[model samples]
Target: MFRRARFAVLFGVIFLVILRYYTTTRHSILDVTEGKTSGPWREEWGHPIKTKQSKGANDTVHDESDEYVNYLRVLHRKHGFTNDVPVATRRIKAKYSKPPLKARPSLAQVKNPLFKDPLGFTRARLDSDNIWLPAHAEIPPLSLPIARTGPRPSSIDASSLLFGISTTYARLTYANNALLSDWAAWLTDGRGSSNGAGLVLTLHGATESQVKTIRDELHHLGIDVTLTASAEGETDAGGRYAQLVQQMMRQRHREPDRKWFALVDDDVFFPCMGRLLSRLQKFDTSETHYVGVPSERADWVIDHGTAITYGGAAIFMTAPMLDTSGQLLCLQYTKTSGQTGLADEEDPGVGMAWDEGLSECLARNTPDIKMDVLPGLFSPTTANAQTNIDDVQRGGGYASGALPLALHRYRNYHRFEAGKGHAVTSACGEDCFLQRFLFKDGWVLVNGYTLTRYDGGVTAEKVTVQTPKKKSGGADSKGAVKPSERLRIVDAEDVNPKERYALSWKGKKKTWRLLDARVKENGEVWQAYVNRRGGGNTVGGDMDDRRPGDIVHHAEEEKSDVDSVILLIWEGEGEK
Candidate 1:
């Protein structure tokens, strides 16, 4: 009996030893299969570092596990997975009108399985800025408030000009409040937008609420916009930029009426949209054309493999160039291979700079297309080279008889600065224009005098006044100089020999009349008082200023000097 009991105990002990060995071997196999067995999971700098692996009994785990891990990583960085998340756009109620339509689902939301929510926020891990979202994959539809509630402007011809501005959410306020406001005033308050013009804004990581805000504030500008989030796992900067280019191409396809398509930074300034369009009219948009001020940093395209289209000022492409198959090829490359070429990589995201990426795209897809360095597109002053706004504008010396197409680096100028009516010290002279008039930037100085009077109108008239002569004891009894009469130049020394000037007088009845005047580069000769009506107000003003020229009143008394000139024209002259 004792021997049998001992045998049973030995058999039990052997079974227990086999069980322990099998368990140890299985754990070791899992360690080898999995990358590495780390410590307990922990958060580091908003990114979740998973240290421990799941010890689940089941082998076939859902792919969502990895996705959830990524989601957690982004969530911690953004909001720490807060349950008290504020419902965006929930408080925006339409009291005067019905609430805006629910935002359309983004392309990524519709196509990518990773983005489950249609319009809801998704953590797109792109760059250190945490900007990209899945919504960036598709282009926003062409949506703009119509003139008579019709489709987008379809009238296309050689004079057609399109403006495409690139911006981001962090800079949204500047774009809408400052830039767009200035643009609208130029279009509505000034005649700069006369030649057919279209504006489009492209933004990234723009939520529905943000889009609604921009649309509501800028509806009157007749501008179209494409606002979307970046793609998921598109950690590379180039990937996000490629997506922007694709959207621009798609926008051009949608609007076939424009001849020239200009891509610019949000801070860029279109001093005079009309003049820019006219200059563009000189170029053939149907041919392959790439226009921009080349950057010094673009020299490394061959060795370091980076090219850039000095985007601070402007980047332009003819409609034909954008319509080419090469652009489509670039689009495909961005979509398939990825914008930054790091979306599918196992390592961290390294985004390509937009300027470099765009340069590469244009070169690779359309090698025949040559990038034209247009010095006129940038401001002559170096201060305006980047997006710096502290100094005179890049194109501040615009009225120096040199018409620049665009000015880069208005980002630093606040709306208040533009409103202060301060002329650029470097550009302004006694009778010379100080700075280019960005209609929104204070008063328009023509020949160093405010173009429009306080009443905001420009009217032409003819007047006669006594010319100023050397005080050679030629004074009347009333202490007025009874000198020979000619024409009056605001300041003879500052006026150019070739340029024309006008003397404006506000009659007792508030009627403004313009008198033509002559100026010589040398202070040898100039007009004292202009008594003849030659040209009308250069800029149109708000409604009530338009009046018949037949109401011209005679000059009551010859003013000593016609310094404060005001153009007496009304909004009726505004075509739109």
Candidate 2:
């Protein structure tokens, strides 16, 4: 009996020992696995990537809860009262948004089994929602060369080109600082007067104090301004004061070397002055030239004759044309809208748009003088700001194949500020923005716009880049083709060049549009491209109804977190 009892106790002890050992081992394994994950672990442990040479990628990890909070910090540092705010108030990131502002907060990581390798931060239900967040701005490689922005390289006299813009004091004070910054970037170096091009500002109803405040801002920005105000008008949008030619002729007369008076709207953007001078130097400055780009809408163009220079596209009038522009003093634009495509039979105009009236008056005087449509100048009238990435990727009005001469309706059609996007020019020089480069990893970089891993593994060898259906040029000195409702611009669905390139592959492609760009003290341009669809989180469809504090059991049930960012750090100067 005693021996049996001892045997039973020993057996029981053995079983207990074995059970304890198994439990400890299992927990240790789990502890190690959990330690390998957790959000911040990605910084220490590099994840393995697997992608096909041509068209396949697989990634199953991302961050769901945390996002890099660099936007607010940047806003504070750039535009906020930096001098008044305490040092603690300057940053949204803990100790990260320091002087010179590198602006890259670390991306936290989570698990997502649905995505491929190249789409590190992309959500699975991309059809439902997507977002673009600011990533990192590392100096980009200097392997490829694009045109740079600097002083005039050629003997072309850029001083002959004088630019003008008309805006109200309220409009000029509120939203035009960034735009005026863009102007300064193109026309002047940091101290202004880099290219010797002049800028004339016609504030519609600015008070003396308002004008003084703006002059202070412009002087600090390095743009020497030829500031003036319009005569008392009925309305700021349009009126008898819209007669700008007489006032502009006075400015034109002030400069003996003035060859062209480029009267542009407040939104017109010149990416590179050298390119503008080159395009203009092609034409005879002595001739009576009425130069502009037609509106994108065929119906609008038909309503306003194609011969009329669209104001936003800029009215580039040569010296002789400026001389004649003064004669149209009779064709004054007014508050009461006038008839389209006519100028009161060459008398004081009532309802016509200033640009249209000018065309009517000029056509009446010199019947042979034609409207010279500037090549590569785009005026996207029917575009939305949110779809700028898709529009450019597919080469809709946002053609990246060629560097633009001037882009009108900047953030109106495009999402980015012209100044920020053009910052790369300081390092890469002119013509670098929106330039394309394909990489071995099946990714492509559209300089200053997007870095993309296209669908169907579109590499340099496989991809065929085609622009949107070429917009028909303006009709000859005659009127435009009968207004057609059928004329639709190239961007129909979400446009990514890959979609247009691979007709066979119908799957989705991914893009990381530029979210933040800034110039460092060392002259490097740091650009961060995030995988968010900007404008809004959802791309094509509407969002689902949701309650607060809900825990999702499956990955597919939750919105994708912005845990991925790609960086393109450009060296301050490219290798010559």
Report the number of the highest-TM-score candidate: 2
Q: Count the backbone clashes (under 3 Å) in each candidate.
A: 30, 28
Q: What would the per-residue lDDT of candidate 1 be over residues 48-136, giving only the tens digit for each residue?
A: 33422433332222332343334333432332212222110000000110232121110000111211233233322322222222222
User: TM-scores of all models?
Assistant: 0.39, 0.59
Worst 10 residues of 2 by lDDT: 87-96
Candidate 1 structure, TM-score to reference: 0.39
lDDT of 2: 0.46
